[model samples]
Target: MALGLFWATVCLCVFVAVLSLDIMGFFSRGNKFQVEGRTVILTGGSYGMGKEVAKLLSQRGANLIIVARNVDKLKAAIEYAKSHAKNPSTQRFHYISADVCSEAENERLLKEATEWNNGKIPEIVWANAGSSTPMMWLESSIETQKQQMDMNYWATAYLAHKTLKAWLYPQTPYSPREKSAKAEAPRHFIMTSSAICFYSFTGYNPYGPAKWAMRGLCDGLRQEVLLYNGARRSTKKTGQEPAPFDINIQMVFPGNMKTPGHELENLTKPPITFILEKDDPEQTELAAATAAIKGLEAGNYYTSTNWLCDVMRISALGGNPRDNIIKDTVGQWLTSIVWLFVGPDLDGKVWNWGKKEGMPELKPEKRIAR
Candidate 1:
């Protein structure tokens, strides 16, 4: 019995070491964006991955507008950027305390950003605010589920729509003609979605549905933006009346993250208690989770080191992915029977940190006729 226990402890240690190595590999290959003099807004920037992204953009001299529900946290984040930013002149930062889940708050936040910039619209907007309910299939509370849906689905959709509409309308001092002349500069709307969108999980009751909805919303909007912009460009070529806007939308499907909220102690409470036990081998897996979460949270899959390359490829290509492509191709399943009998595949589709190389390049392709 003593020998068996010793071997078990050794095996667990080895497994953890391997997991840490895999996660570290992803971080080494992370794609860092160099943006300067560009206006970028990030929701949930008060802490965790959002704050890190703000710090990154600040370092690159990008004007930042950080949003979160906490006013104090937002202020602190703004202060941090002010202190850490390299070229403060090139990076003007602002903060707006609002809930991304509320439509009124979304409109108010965008309006505030524009107003703060003297009516100049932001060139890059990242819809990165999200809340999760990691409850078992049956244990999720009504309030938790509703909040997740609001933050994860409706809030994302509302903010995306508002941001796109604002981007489409020509701003003051820059008329439609001036904007059209600079066609090469694509306006970006980066949606922070999730990889669970590609597959279902027994542990994800409400959160999965909301995230899946975000994927659908992104796909639909992606097609619309392409169609809208394509028609405008075609009209310009024919010397006819041109359509209004040229917008490029990018959707991101983040995996597990290591935000403060994702702490194992917090997750082991209330809603998440059923899904995660303190004694589980993967119970306190923060580094792996951070790799997955930070990847999508960074506004691109490559940012997460390479865990979500497949989803990013589909988003950039502007093509509808067949349902269950990730699940079928990668074999990710989280059904009750599977979870109970097979246990979580810590290294499979749920946590693929090395697949970033397979992501499709972001080269622009000629638009196909509708």
Candidate 2:
């Protein structure tokens, strides 16, 4: 009798959970990331997931400006985006060659993009330009660490800062009449972070922290935007013309994408790092970008491109908002329970690797002077 009662309760819980999820799905039906006829600035669009995202956005009728340092690749990416445009005659595509790692260049890119868009700031800005040079903490040079931070964290920060300032504090403030004349869709600022931000392993000392910093920035901005959004809605009482539209701050956490950047990363990846992440699933650039866009449309703040990344994300959610509170709460509990075992298991692997392989030897050129 007790065994039957236990089974019955389990089935009842499962049914309730499924029913709740279905009901939530019903309420969240419409696409939140509507981009038709909007202007978008996409950094690092010359290759990898950025290029794939540009193509997808073009298909959705967004006017695109792709930015990268390589002029040849930028030209190719623009042509590719133009070819996939939904309205070939109406949609426009352009490319800019600039190193986004430089703060001045990021500002210039946004200014140029605004100018190109007839003095209106882009509705969407995606900071997807980043690089990784994975190595053990001591094995990596200080210059390499700084470079990783510059590319992964500072570049995104600089762009987000300039874009938000332009969006919220426009030089020519919106008139009350202007604000009421048109109901604008929410503006979106997206940053690309790595799954390593959630849980890092050996050989990612230089890269992982930079990605983690991006998560911190995203979390803080997500909360900060709420203040501006609230103030925008209370314009009558404040007697101030609010921002043109509500701002949406989001981040994408992608894992193991098969791109040219991934190939370059592998060339510097340590052998132990390979063993640790050998089981991780790799996605084609298109698959990763598709998942990211789907998450955006679903109104997810922290979008994970795969199941593993989702698990990692929930495990380290910290102060980030949960897209589905009930689902994320349950997942978080399960992940916490699982990590009790996973954490030790990963540590054991690292220890065993050291015992089996001895200390890793640095190349002669990599050695610091005594």
Candidate 1 lDDT by residue in tens digits, 1-370: 9999999999989766765675466334433333577788889788766777677667767789999988889999898777767786555889998978889898898888877876777778888888665644455567767877998888878888787766664442322233345344456777776656755554666688997788777777867887668776563465344434456566655455546666542443332233333232231223433443444334342222233434333433324543323332332333333445434553243334236436324332221221
- Model 2, CA-based lDDT: 0.87
Can you tell me which runs of candidate 2 are displaced by over 4 Å? Answer: 1-25, 172-181, 235-240, 364-370
Top lDDT hit: 2
Q: Using alpha carbons, what is the TM-score of model 1?
A: 0.65
Against the reference, the lDDT scores of all candidates come to 0.62, 0.87
Off by over 4 Å in 1: 1-34, 171-180, 236-245, 264-370
Q: Lowest summed lDDT over 10 consecutive residues: which window, candidate 1?
A: 361-370
Q: Number of clashing residue pairs in every model?
A: 4, 0
Positional deviation of residue 56's Cα in model 2 after best superposition, in angstroms: 0.5
Q: Write the per-residue lDDT of candidate 2 for residues 1-370, one digit (tens) a residue.
A: 9999999999989868786876568657689999999999999899999999999999999999999998989999999989999999999888888888999898888888887887778899999999878767887878878988999999999999999988877763321123454658999999999999999899899899999999999999999999989886673666455685799999999999888778777777778889888898999999999999999999999999998999999999766688977668778999999999989988888999999999778762142211
RMSD of each: 14.9, 3.8
Q: How far is candidate 2 from the true structure (C-alpha RMSD, Å)?
A: 3.8
> How much is 213 displaced in model 2, in angstroms?
0.4
